[model samples]
Target chain A: MTPKISQFLSQKNPSTPCLVVDIDEVELRYRAMQAALPAARIYYAVKANPARPLLDRLVFLGSCFDAASWEEVDLCLSAGARPENISFGNTVKKVSAIKAAYDAGVRLFVFDCVEELEKLARFAPGSRVYCRLLVNNHGAEWPLSRKFGTTPESARTLMLRARELGLDPYGISFHVGSQQLSADAYEVAIAQAGSLLADLAADGLRLRMVNLGGGFPIQYRDDVPGIAHFGQVISRAMKIHFGETLPEILVEPGRFIVGSAGVVSTEVVLVSQRGRDEGPRWVYLDIGRFGGLAETEGEAIRYMIRTARDGEEVSSVALAGPTCDGADILYEKSCYTLPVTLEAGDRVEILATGAYVSTYCSTRFNGFAPLAEHYI
Target chain B: MTPKISQFLSQKNPSTPCLVVDIDEVELRYRAMQAALPAARIYYAVKANPARPLLDRLVFLGSCFDAASWEEVDLCLSAGARPENISFGNTVKKVSAIKAAYDAGVRLFVFDCVEELEKLARFAPGSRVYCRLLVNNHGAEWPLSRKFGTTPESARTLMLRARELGLDPYGISFHVGSQQLSADAYEVAIAQAGSLLADLAADGLRLRMVNLGGGFPIQYRDDVPGIAHFGQVISRAMKIHFGETLPEILVEPGRFIVGSAGVVSTEVVLVSQRGRDEGPRWVYLDIGRFGGLAETEGEAIRYMIRTARDGEEVSSVALAGPTCDGADILYEKSCYTLPVTLEAGDRVEILATGAYVSTYCSTRFNGFAPLAEHYI
Candidate 1:
């Protein structure tokens, strides 16, 4: 725990668990992504902690929206995002939810099967649809093929059926899984989507868009590629597939939007012996699995936990939550040393996990406190 | 997916990620526990769901309250529980929370260290303190030796300090851990608490209560011991040590009380082939890791998932969550099969997990719907 962190919380507000978003960082990243892909469409996946202020800012920056549920759709609409720009992309949606989206004028719906397509057609025929195709493993770092995606053998058949039903099948989309490390997988998925569209050309269907789904690695971990390098690969794949005239590129990047700009600020509750042995003591922090820090498998997302004010250092201590459960630990082990006198009530901030944090947290385990989101 | 399940959901409500409490089953279990442990005092741990209706029933049944936070304290007080009957038993508590409990006339608080005790004294001076002792390995199936609790030497020192500070320390408590399969762990923990209290007596501190904390197991899994069988071992230990008279036996039962009675009803959206060359097929359910079905170290909590209306024949199928992530599988290989002929839009109820289900769920992964809770 950092001494400056305690002083900072005392100075502002003494809330236990709160998400602090660096607005400048988010703006910079969004601007960078916009600059790189000028013609490509960017849909901000709002499932990643849909703070209203963040949403309002994203809309102000002229970004389109990709909503998963009617609630997210409502949130975007309330924030003044155009309904036509909002694409409802979850695989399994309730009938009422489908009707609600259609009634709200959301035209682009992602479909993986004939069942979903039929359901959409019955509820909202003439709506624009995107047929999601499942790309086979072309040596990707994790076989995320288990998730929702129509396989190659069935994609052509599904597209033909959509055409027969008089629904405007606007595009094809496939993600190489989130946190994808290799450019090869993206290239293969794009090639696969292009080949499927080409195969369906005998039906006289003109593919207006091809979405090589966003798994462009952000290099949070050691082995993932940088965004700029991955951009070059995407550009190359688009040129190779479309023969000098590419369709519009649509990418949904949830983590890449605000994941690195957010930190869960917490306070130290206790520092005690981890065991009876003469080993390192564990420093219990206010945040736990309850605070969305549990996303990492038994390890906390790396954040610079130190004095929030003067940046005074503190000794390395094992971070533990207040929950009685043993698995409620935040960090596997302490990595950094501190300089200040840290004790009970000292504050610590967990970093780089803004996406899919707090708003997607389980606030009911052993009474862990929720973080107050402060946009920087 | 069971055939009967699909029929029910298509006919009835088909919502994704909803929790339902079997009130009849809960009442039966509550009565059975009350009958078995007539001599002991029972306190329902509010950390588990804390349903208002359930708490009301427990209050009417006359169980003392166990509160872990100010929110729980507020809930109990609002539910008309006398502050005297409620024990604020969390080891690490905020100063404001302690002060709030003190203002509410809460008298007893549990402390795990000298620092916590000191914090309690500063806020709620002259209140009786219960020092939590570290239970040595008593062979509990899942020993909770870590997190809270001090060593014997440190506990003794803390007790001596409490006396010096002109404060009264009344008791010792030790939780063996949750879901204990072996009864021997309770004996060992009680013996351990007794030995420490005996040593404290030698130091001239009069200890009134010895809370051999609750870890009585429930049969979520087959191998876990039955409540009655585990109760025998606990009662026998109390008789052997205290000899027909003992400090109030406060057993904190959350999962044992409401776990079996609670069920989550989810809609089966898609039935997909798991792997080629015959791996198996999966019925993707609406709930995921964020829903109370989060697996502990990749093993989901054991539950009997079945259809509500029909006694249809069952078949094996893996239940996957709606999240795009591969880790969101509820159960990779379900032990028991549900009724057959389950297809898209079927409802499956996962039983015996009411305790932690709704309190720890998120509906926004991959833009999924929010978790809705209903208590009957």
Candidate 2:
């Protein structure tokens, strides 16, 4: 356990199945990222954990925001972020949402297709727009599919079309992928961005900004490089490609900023053997995939878990959420070992779950309330 | 397209990404179940779409309810269901929820362990309790894991303990599985329950009820036996095992009551080709895994999909959700073929989605609203 978690648990006793975010850890992460990549502006992605408190804290720290829609832009603005500092990062958006964001004073937007570019030109004319370039995301733990970006050839046409349609062809952007593990992924993506920049420059279009989309990995169960290493790798790539004439560099880091700053405390509802006397024991918790941890879909992402009865004799158990639905089972194939003495009411803490939890929680399922959240 | 969906679309134009429940279909299904299983009591499971309109309609039809939580009990009561007609079906429940249900005059409750029985003994003394027996769910389309219920030995002990603890050990219940396909599954489960019932009878305890828990399959993308066939199979099993003396038979049907009654209308957000030029076409929709179709997790349950341009030239396409998350991709391996000319803003109707779609919807993810529900 990290000292931050130990300190928070020592001071506070929250209700079971509650998410407790350590604000101090958020501050530490933000400062570390800032120190590592001083030349890059950080636009905190609000979708990770859009709790008002975290947004307010980030705003107080003078952090820019990467808003996905009009609602997110409103969330940031309500948290006191300057509208100019918020970028509409989603490439596929409804025309009404585009108008809503433009009306709310959001000037920077992202687009990947001619349809989106046309929507932008009509809804938010003369707004600064960035074209997203398609890149390989094989190494990312959460490998993003070909969902958001366009090919290099298609991006060129879109950028040129943006200028013709009375929208500023601001720059280019690419997401390595969420929970990207290696700095080499950034090197490859940065090199791709560099080539796109050169190609666009050859067409006599001088782009003013480049968005290195959110994908910075955080330490969970696996080892990951620190923010400084990512910064060094990114800085080296930019220098080799763009030299000293680098455009205004912006980085969106959602997980790295808040992933480690939060911890979820849940209680064991039941621990029972299913089949025969010697069959595997199933441990049920008040929280599950629908409760807040939707990322556990297919058990792709594993959160580092700790029990109050740690250091005791342990056995592997299948973990499940407290719901009548059979699909609520959390970790069945990828089972976790808990203290043999663990029983009902025993607490378990899931670490580094601040991001993608609360936002993904359903309103109510099987009479269980949504996961409550607390910030320290 | 199903005639129900076609008529709905032809008569009324609901907004995109909306759930349209045909109340007429619900009435037909309810009446069919009543005609098929006249000897068994039907308790509509409220967890599967607890929309007030449906509850009120079910109440008008003199339907009993199988409530999962206190909130569901309240919904049933508000829908004009008598307290005695409601059964607290979920085995895993919070103590507070149990107390709330008891206070609301709910008498019947289900449990599978000593812990839950004790909770009932404290909160709902003298209340009738049913013990759930473990059963195999091997061939179910949505096969339930070992999430609920206990072994026969444990259940026997629990029932006796319930009698000793001032709680009424009323009956036994078992769920074959959700979307249970085979009649043989029910036959085997009924045999297990009958043996347990006979053993408990030999112990001088008279149990008065047997809950054949809900798993009646509905037609979606494949053929399933009607409610009459399930009733025949169950009746045959009961006659073979229990002979003349039979307990009060009760069935809790959630999906069967509402599954075929609803259709979801969604707009195609984008249709683009990914990877190589010959690769599969990717079709994105306004709704996705988080948007309410969570049962599609692992593509276990396939909803019948139809487009407005259904008769046009068809080609296979990979379907996805509108969310920015990579895991939002809906069907890749089990791909759907749609009109080759399908484009953004075209409508698609997902049939037989009325049961598990609305209540499971999250409030917002990526700033997209939860699925809008409409009853016709």
lDDT per residue for candidate 1 within A274-356, as digits (tens), equals 32566445777776766566555445234455454335655556667776666677664636454446777776666566777
* lDDT per residue (tens digit) for residues B1-376 in model 2: 3476677777888777899887778888899988888888999989888888998899999999999888889889988999999999988777768889999899999988787788889989999999988889977877765678888998888889999999989999999999998988999999999999999999988788889988899987878887789889999999887889889999999899899999889988767663236767888888888888888877878888887788999888888887777777778778678899998778888889999888777767776677888887
Tell me the DockQ of each model, to 2 decimals: 0.39, 0.49
Could you tell me every candidate's TM-score relative to the true structure? 0.87, 0.92
Which parts of model 2 are misplaced by more than 4 Å? A1-15, A164-166, A203-208, B1-14, B164-166, B202-206, B274-276
Model 2's DockQ score: 0.49
**lDDT over C-alpha atoms for residue A125 of model 1:** 87
Choose the strongest candidate by DockQ: 2
Q: What is the C-alpha lDDT of each candidate?
A: 0.71, 0.85
Model 2: per-residue Cα lDDT over A1-376, one tens digit each: 4576677676776777888888778888889889999998999988887888888889989999998778889999998999899999987676777889899899999988776787889989999999988888977878774666878888887888899999999999998888888889889888888888888899988888889988898877678888889899999999998888998899998888899999888888777765357756888888888888888777867788898788999988888888888778788787678898998777889889988888788867775667888887
Clashes of each: 19, 0
